[model samples]
Target chain A: MNNEHAEVMEMHMPTEKIVGQTDLYSIKSSTVRTPDAMPRPIRVKAREVNVFYGSKQALFDVSIDVPERAVTAFIGPSGCGKSTFLRCFNRMNDTIEGSKVTGRIELDGADIYDGSIDVVELRARIGMVFQKPNPFPKSIYENVAYGPRIHGLASAKGDLDRIVETSLQKAGLWNEVKDRLHEPGTGLSGGQQQRLCIARAIAVSPEVILMDEPCSALDPIATAKVEELIDELRENYTIVIVTHSMQQAARVSQRTAMFHLGYLVEEGPTDKMFTNPEEKRTQDYITGRFG
Target chain B: MNSLIVATLLLILIGFAYQVGWSRSRQVAPAGGRLHSRPNYHGARVAIWALVPALLILGLWAFFSDAASRAFVMAQLPSDVRAMGGSELAQALSRIEQIATGFGVVGEPAPYESAAGQALREFRNLAFALVVAAAAGTGALGLYLARRRIAPRLRARDEVERVVRYLLIACSVVAILTTIGIVASLLTEALRFFTFVSPIDFFFGTVWNPRFSTVGAGTGEYGLLPLLWGTVMIASIAMLVSLPIGLMTAVYLTQYARPNIRNAVKPVVEVLAGIPTIVYGFFALVTVGPFLAGIGDLVGLDIRATSALTAGIVMGIMIIPFISSLSDDIIRQVPRAMRDGSLGLGATQSETIRRVILPAALPGIVGAFLLAVSRAIGETMIVVLAAGNSPYLRLNPGEPVSTVTVTIVNQLTGDTDFASPQSLVAFALGLTLFLMTLILNVVALFIVRRYREQYE
Candidate 1:
């Protein structure tokens, strides 16, 4: 059933690439560029994104398209600017002092960096989960309800309650926390706390959820649970995850982009990228020759 | 002889002992075998043993030398001098001791006194010689024993660590004992005051007219109510002025201010703390007092130049850094992750601070406020200069009212006998203030601990 749907998605997506176009896939590396490869519709598109922190350029001109209802994992070593690019989608970099981002990022064809864009509304549309579990120092229920309450997405107490419950249910945390929802979110285990943070992001019902190495702080069992949750969530949400683990990129992502030294090295179907990467650096990174 | 000379000689002796022990430990250890502890541990152990025994003997010698010399001088006095009253005999002895020390006698001494002065000089020399002999002997014995005990398996490090632990415990015990001594002295003096004035009348009486009663005919009212009320009122005003401004300053420094601005502004605000309270007192008495009176006249309200309002406001300014710095540290400690979590959820910075950061930092902020209040309550110079020291029971802050600290200062500094009710009342008030500060600090510590546990 999923194979048939994927075939239909591939047919609907654009198939041809102009030889000299500036689209994400058309920018050829010396080794390879997989144009017209992604099967799903692009939910977010970044063009020539360059980021600087206090005069030091941390990211070169890099761009990628995040597809809808699919996981696009950015894999790289530490300080490789994968996380930096992910933050540009929701304008999270705006919160960092001395950090400057120059380029265009579009969510549903609307320029996110335009002066008319309200950052608060933009963040509501594109949520983020951190590398570490960062549930607020509030009750479990309140942690889940925080987003909906802040954006006034729920008008009534009952609506907020339902939102919290549905968000927790979607994050696979409702059963474990339902009886003790009033307990402090910090009192939970690390894995449970990360799930609570995930539930918090989902409560807003964002169009895209950005996960920055979400399972990096978790044990293997917890990582498996989060990966499973990610697989289930891709049915409804466009997920863009940045991960240091190549295995995690393989297990959870449908399309994978490898970054090196602040540049997007290569991007293609996850299976093809792992099995037959055209870029030497991408193969080197995935095969653990060197990060 | 100078005490510094003795202390220097003792240190030199300990250094020599360390060298001897270090060499001996190296000799005893097999060339190829590993020693249980480093040579320095052995050296330190020997030095500590030598220094401690010598210090004990020196302390004992110093404690008894004066009494030994005085007793010798007293024995040398004639029977007639011995028959004198106790104070007169003491005076004679003091004069003889003064003559011995060549500090010059207050009056002409009799023949017997002159002879006693000579005998006092002899006794002092004998005491000094005996002290030196005993200290040297004890130090030598300690050095010899420690050097002999230095072996490859001596466990010198453990021994030294044990001594270090005891020394640390002794230092803490000294602090605790000093606090206990202070509280005990206060309790005794307060008990004496209560003997003169009943506790019920003192605690519950609204009047605070402590008349100067020398003959104990009728001790005046020593009511604590008015002073307590004044302290509460001034502290409330100080809190009212400080709490919002200080908390806002902390929030701005922690969350809103840029790094360079925060770095620049934080210390500048903390400069308010470094400005001595006396300076604040001067500002209150000379500047704020008159300014308040001018505003009062403009509004047709009678405000004293030196009133609770002026004092409270100035004190609030004085403690602004105390509250702001502590609250800034606490708010900063609320984990960047917590703030990011809220901000990631689309909450604006202020909303995140108000709902997440402040709530997480609430216990710590409460602790900081309590600490500030305790500081405000115990403050003396500002209140002394500006509160006007009027022991009135009125609730009007514009009226001159005295706090506990100010009243204690007023009662203690006046020319009255220490045994009198007025002077003894200072100790009673001091004890009350100390207990209040103690309780507040305890509660603050508890809250801060709980707050730490929450995030950590």
Candidate 2:
């Protein structure tokens, strides 16, 4: 290998040491042209984000920018903080009584943790689908309609019906359960139940959709179906997904972030990151050197 | 008695035969091929075959012998007494039973007396003969069947399974028969009560005065309205006091409390539930009742020491653990994934609880509430002491109010004539209590069904 390629492969761990030493001129230049080259508006920005759960600190200062109308993927090994950073996007760590998060997070230029913001309203703007399919014991129609009704997104019965139909259509589940919308959501197969949860999240028309290992519980065919839906979802909403499958992240995301032991080891364009990573850890991880 | 013992001996003999047969079969079958089931199973199978039919026949013969044996023995009496009314005949027949069983007879043992003694002697001998014959007949039949089925394809296991199924059905029938018997007796007495007090007067008359003046002219008006009102008021107060505290405590313990705190607090709180209602009764009567009466005096209000408030409060305290435990389980089962899903949506902790946890648990909560209501209504000891004997119709929770259960106790703990309105009133109150509790239980069952539908 050439000296340049070898150097790029080994640049990640020491990148943190250089973070404090980076001159003012270097950071400004590095962050400047990326936004313009990007295809969509910048929707969310994170800088120096660190998280700790009880006595164990999980994420190092991780910075990433999520662009609107595109998919961003977080790929890493177990305990690598990929899902932890994904949770930070939604402030889900708040539920863990002793979890502590410190950083700057801006959604459309407003601090998400600002006293002016309502978490409910913010969550309405940011929907979520879990790793496992979790639909309320209610019917498919009611499951999809719950968010809309709770948030008053649909004020009339006709509006609610349209919302349910359109949400299910968006989730690629309208065909299988269109006739049995009144049937229990749990009565459906595992894959179909996951799709119903997606429909439920979409009923309120969220601006960003965060998925944590969304397809880990799915079979290959169901995973493929969700991948196709993610591609389409990027047309209207920013998508950030945490995944263990490198191929899934490669197939769905435009930008990929690699984490290791709570550090953002690498972040770059997916094609470049896969074929020619700027960091050795990222290269070793994607090539299965070590988990 | 001698023949019953002979029948019992025959039963044991056949049972021993079956056990020996099974052990021999097990030992022999395994030499050529393994036995079809465990050795114990085969032994039990044989014992069942020997005992079941013999016991059924003996029981049937014993039950059917009551009237005919009496008639047969009486037929040997003098002509006038032989045709006596059922009561007189029964009296004479008892004399025969006493003389037969050797309970020393009296009254000079009149004309038919010797005939009755001889008749009793004959009937005893016949019953002994009949019982022994039936047991021997059934046992011989079972032995013959077992011997005929000596082939390898006898499939004793299948026969045993059938027997087991029938036994299970019989056991369930016993339970069902007991419930039906209770309902029938309650209904009969309740019908007798309705003959005196019209349903409307019993339901809505607002007075519960029962006249027990032995004079025939005493016609007391007994109405259920006061007792019904008292029951409702006390139950409502109990529910109001228990619902929020129990539910919130459950939520706190399950969702927010640290492990150490939860472990320490839960058993202490449940200790309240384990206390006997009777203990709570005296506590309410001795402590809360007098304390409240004192508070009432200070406020320039007239309140009895034993009042609805004391009982209701005590009942509420007793039921908190029930509500808390049930709601805790329901909340815990709300699917960790659901909580995760809500949190992942950027919903705050309280927001997620209010929207997801509470909604998911609503059906279960309703079920818990309904069960609590039934428990409160049926509660007796706590109310009997703290709630006074007064059955006056009034809405003041501080005033002494008697519930239906208290009235039932008051009217039934004596040797009064059963025909009196006061004595029969207990059965009437019991029937009303039964119907009310039945409705509450049914409603609670429906709520549980609805709650289960969400998960299933």
- What is the lDDT, from 0 to 100, of the residue A20 in candidate 2? 21
Error of 2 at A221 (Å): 6.9
Among these predictions, the greatest DockQ belongs to 1
Task: List, residue by residue over A95-185, the lDDT tens digit for candidate 1.
Answer: 8899999988999998999999998998898989999998888899989988898898998999999999999999999999999999999
In angstroms and one decimal each, the interface RMSD of every candidate reads: 0.8, 2.6
Per-residue lDDT tens digits for candidate 2, residues B1-456, read 675686568667667857765765665574567666555556666666667777777778778877766777767787888778688877888887777677758876765776677777778788768776777678667765664454444566777789999989999999999999998988888888888778788877877788664645665888898998889888988998899889999999988898889999999999999899999999999998899899999999888888888888888889999999999999997888888776655455676688789888988899899999989998999899998868998878988899999988888876677777778778888988999989988998898888787765
Residue range with the least summed lDDT across 10 consecutive positions in model 1 chain B: B211-220
Number of clashes recorded per candidate:
0, 1
Chain A TM-score of candidate 1 vs. true chain A: 0.87
Residue B344 CA displacement from its true place in model 2, Å: 2.7
* TM-score list, all predictions: 0.93, 0.75
Summarize candidate 2's per-residue lDDT along A28-52 as a digit string, tens digits.
Answer: 3332223225567789999899899
Against the native complex, each candidate's DockQ, computed on alpha carbons, is 0.61, 0.36
CAPRI-style quality class for the chain A–B interface of candidate 1:
medium
